[model samples]
Target: MGTSASKLAILDIVLNGLMRRYKERVPDVGIILDAMVSDGIVKSTSDIENDHIAFRTMGVPQLGVKSFEKIFLHFGYEKRDHYFFEGKKLDAWWYSPPRATDPRIFVSELRVGDLSEESQHIIHSYTNEVTVDGIATDPVDYLDLDNGEAVDAFLHQPLWRTPTTADYQSLLQESEYAAWVIYNRYYLNHFTISVHNLPEGYNTVASFNDFLEKHGIKLNTSGGKIKVSPDGGLLQSSTVAEMLDAEFANGEKLRISGSYVEFAERKVLPEFASLPAGEIKRKHRRDGFEAGNADKIFESTYTTQTGR
Candidate 1:
C-alpha cells in the first residue's frame, strides 16, 4: 500500500473488471472493437489505448464525488479540474491516472438540491435506501480500497432499490442523469479510446467518426459528430448510450439508456509538435479535459442523443 507500484497493479485489476462489465453491459464496446480490427486500426482490442473511463453518481449525503473518489485516490489517481454543468444541474471533476498510460477518470454528480421539490423527493426516495441499509455514512468508508476485487464488486453493485417506472419517468422529466443512477448506480458510465495514437487515417476524431459510422455505430450528435476544445488541442466523440431492456420494480419492463463508448484525440502540445511521434508522450499532449467538450460528451446518455 505504501508503494505506488503495488497499488498500481491492484488498480489494473480493478480497471479491467470495470471494463469487462462495461463491455458486457454496453454491446457497442464490442462492436466498436471489432470494427477497429476489421478496419485494421489495431490487431486486437488490447492494441487500443483507453483514454479514460467515467462514472455518474448521486450528490447526496455520504455519496457523490467525495465518497466515490476515495477508491481511485487510494491507488494513485490525482483529482484535477472542476467542471460544472449548469444546465444539467451537475458538478464534475477529472482525475489524472496514477500512470501516464492509465486512463483518466471523469466523475459527475447530480446536484440533487438543484432539482425541483418533487424531483428531489424522487431521488431521495431511492438514495435513502442506501442509508437505511445501514450504510449510515459513506459506503466507501467501509470499503478496503486496497482490495481490488472488493472495490470492483462495489463499483458494479446497486446502491439503492430499483426505482419504480413512474419514479424513473418523473426524474427523467427533470434530470436524465438522476433517472440513470437510480437504476445503473456505480456502473462504469463509459470508457474512452485514445484515438490520437491510432493509425494516420483513424487517429483523428473526424476520421474515427467516419470509420465508426461505416460500421453502423451510432454517434452522439448533440454537439455535432465531433466536439472540439476552443484551444483545438482536444477532440472527442462518443456513441449514443444504447437502450437496454431493463426490468423495473414489480416486473415492469422498459427500454432505458445504458453505457456507451467514447473516442478522444488529445493533440500534442504546441511545444511538442516538432518532436517525432515516437518521442511524444502524454505529458507532451493536452493533459486534462475541457468543460465545453465534456458538456456535450455528457449527453451521450441523454435522450436528446440516445433517442436518435
Candidate 2:
C-alpha cells in the first residue's frame, strides 16, 4: 500500500514500547499484530488481569480471548482454523498480521497468467522489480512461488510495485502496508496524550514527502517507495514525531515522558488506582472466587523516596 512505510514506522514504535514495559510478560510480536487488525488497539494490563479474574470466577472475560482458538478463529480474521498446538489451539492473535485501517491499503487481486499486456509491461518497466539480486529472473516463476505461501521470497525479495486501489481510476488509493495502533495505557500513569504537545526531538513524521521536504532530503516520490538518501535517511518512527508531522495546520505536539516511579506516584498510587482492586474484590465475593494454584500473589507494596 502507498502508506505501508508509514504504518510500519508506527508498528515499530508500539513494538518498542511493549517490549520496554512488559519485557518477558509482553506478548509475542505476532499477538500484537493480530490484536491490532481486529481491535485497532491492545488491551491494558488492568484489562487483561480483569479478564483473567473473569475466567476464574465468571468463566468469561469482557473481551479477552478465552482460548487460543478463539484468538485465531475469532480475532485473527481467519475463516478457518489452520493450525493447532499440543491439543490446545494456538491463539491466532499471535500469528495474524495487522491490517491497515486506511482504505488505501487494499490492492487489486492479480492473477498469474491473466494479467493484461499493460500490466505485464508495467511490471517489466521497473529496473529492479523482476530481478533476483539485480539479475533478471523469470517473472512467471516468481509469481508461481508468490501464489503459494512463499511470501518471504516474493514480498521481501522484490517485485513490481502493486497498486493498492480497488479501481485504478480512483484518486484515493489504498495502502498495502500493515499497521497496528496502541493507546496510552492508564497503568502507564499518563492521560491519553494527543499528537500535539510533543517536544521537538521526540517527534516523527508519517507522510513520506512531508518528512523528506521538511528535512531537505531529495527523492523521487511518484510510486510508493522512496529512494533512501546516502545519509542515515529519514528517522521514521511512530512516537510523537509522526503526530507533529501530521496534516494538522493548527495542532501542537504532545509530550508525556517520565520515570516509572513518577508514573506510579501519579496514577497507580492515587485513590482511583483501587478501581480495579475494588472490582476484583467484588467479583471474588459474588462468585465465591477461589484463588487458583496460588502461584502468584496479588499484593501491592509502595515505598516513597525522601530527599534529605
Candidate 3:
C-alpha cells in the first residue's frame, strides 16, 4: 500500500477495534454507523474522516492523564492546550496528531480531590484495588511506537475494579465522572466525524443533525443541540448515549447510558475562505476544541441527558 493507504489501514484497524468494543457496550453505534453508510453520507467506514476521539480518565495519583497519555505520545501525538470545566470538575487537554490524516485526541480526567472525601474514598478504593501504586502498568509494557496491537490493547484495557451498586449510586449522586470511569474503564468515550469534509449541503452541523434526526437518532440538548465556538468557527453536536445493561459488582444489573458518537464542523478561517475549496487544508480550518462547546458535549452520556 502507498503511505496514505497504509495510514488509512492502520486507522481503520484501530477504529474497527474501538467500534467493536463500543458497539458491544452501546448498540446504537452500530445502528448509527451502518445508517451513515447505507444513507450514502459516507461511501464506506474508511471514507469518514474523524476530527478527533475522546477518552475519560480518573484524576488519581497513579492512573490519571499522564499514564494514559503515554500510549498516544508513543504514537507521535503531542499534547496541546488545557481546558478546565469547573462545574464538571474536569481538567482536559487536546493532542495534535503526527500525521494530517490521523485524528486529534482529547482526554479529560475527573478531579478526584475536588470531590467530597467520601466520594474520593469510593473512587480510590476501586483504583487502589486495580494497582498497588494506583498507577497503570499495562501501557508501559506496550511502549513500542510501531506496535499497533499495543495501542489497541491500551485503549481497551480494564483499569479498575467494578464498583458495587450502592457505591455506584453514591458516586453518581456526587460525581457522574466517577461512576462512568468505574464501569467504562479506558474505552473510547466518543469519536467525532469531521463534518466540514462532507460534501456540500451536508458540511454544516445543522445539516448533519438533520440527517441524524431523520434516522431516528436523538441528540443531547443540554446546551442546545448545536454548541458553537465563540468565533463561530467550530460547531458540534452529539447523540444522547444509548442505555446499556450494566451488572454491578454486587450482581445487580441496571440499564445505564453508555458512550456516544460526536459530529464536528470546522469552518475555514476568514483568511482562507477566499481561497478555492480545493486549496484548503486541515490547518486552514479551526483546529482546536472549545471549552464552552466541550463542556456541554460532555453531558452526552450523563443520565440526565440520556434519560437512563
Candidate 4:
C-alpha cells in the first residue's frame, strides 16, 4: 500500500484499539487518561493536536488537553502516524478552565516547528533534570487540589544525571511509563516535528538513536498518536481569525495566548517591544583575562574563570 494509505490504515487500527481499550477500561482509568491526553504541551509531528491553553498560568488547575470531538461530544479517539508506536492513542476527554478572551474561544495549534531553538533547548534541558514533582510542583501542584493536596503525588527525579545507552536500557528495566515519558520529553526538546493538522499524524515516531544518526526517521511502531488535519482541527476558526485581527494579528500576538488578551492589553502590550540590555564585557573581564586574543589555550588548564 502507498505511504498515505498505509498511514491511514494504521490509523484505523489504532482507533479501533483505543475504542476497545476505552470500552474495557473507561470507568477505571479514563480520568487519568483523559488528563494526560488533554494536557499535552509539546507538539510532536503527530500525537494530540489543537492544544488550546484556555487558562494561562493563573487559571487551569493543571495544563489540560482534549480533542474538539471530546469537547463537543465527550467522546474521542486516538490514531497512529503509520505503523510506528502501538497502543498510544487516547479517546478520553478532560475539563480545563474557561476562556477570558473574546466571547468566541480560540485555540492555539503550536507545532514543533514553531518553537525557537532557545525554547526547544529549555524544554530539553528541563526534561532530563526535571522530576514529576519538579514539573508539577509549581503550577499543577498548586492548582490541582485533591483534599487540599496534589493528586497523583509521586516523587520524580532524573533516573540518571547523564544518560548513556546503558542508562536508557536500565530505565527500560524500571517503569516503562516513566522511561517513555522522559524519552518523549527529551525527544521533544531536540528535534522539530511537523504538526500540520489533526485526524492524520500528530506525533513523530522516529527512534532517538536513529534521530541522532542520519538514518531514516521512524514513527513509533508500537504506540499510536492523535490525528491531524490541515486546518488545525478546531483551531482553524479561532487562530485563523486571530491572524485576521488588525491589532493583534501581526505576529506579536502570535506569542501571547488569546486568553491573555486582557493582560496583553493592560501590561504586555506596553512592554511588548521593551527589552533590558546588560553589558557582558565587564562580567567577562572580571572573570579574568588579559586583553589579548589567544588562538589556543592550555587544554588541561583551560577553565572558566570564577567570579570573586
Q: For model 1, what is the alpha-carbon lDDT of residue 88?
A: 91
Cα lDDT of model 3 by residue, 228-260, tens digit: 999999999998987778888868888877789
Q: Rank the candidates by TM-score, best first.
A: 1, 3, 4, 2
For 198-289, candidate 2 gives per-residue lDDT tens digits of 22331222342243344433322212222222232212111111111111113332221211110000012233345654353322221111
Decide which is better by TM-score, 1 or 4: 1
Worst 10 residues of 1 by lDDT: 128-137
Assess every candidate by TM-score. Answer: 0.97, 0.18, 0.91, 0.19
| Number of the top TM-score candidate | 1
Error of 1 at 168 (Å): 0.3
Top-scoring candidate (lDDT): 1
- lDDT of each structure? 0.89, 0.22, 0.83, 0.22
Itemize residue pairs with steric clashes in candidate 3: none
- lDDT: the better of candidates 1 and 4: 1
Model 4, stretches more than 4 Å misplaced?
A: 1-93, 100-160, 182-308
Model 1: CA > 4 A from native: 1-3, 132-135
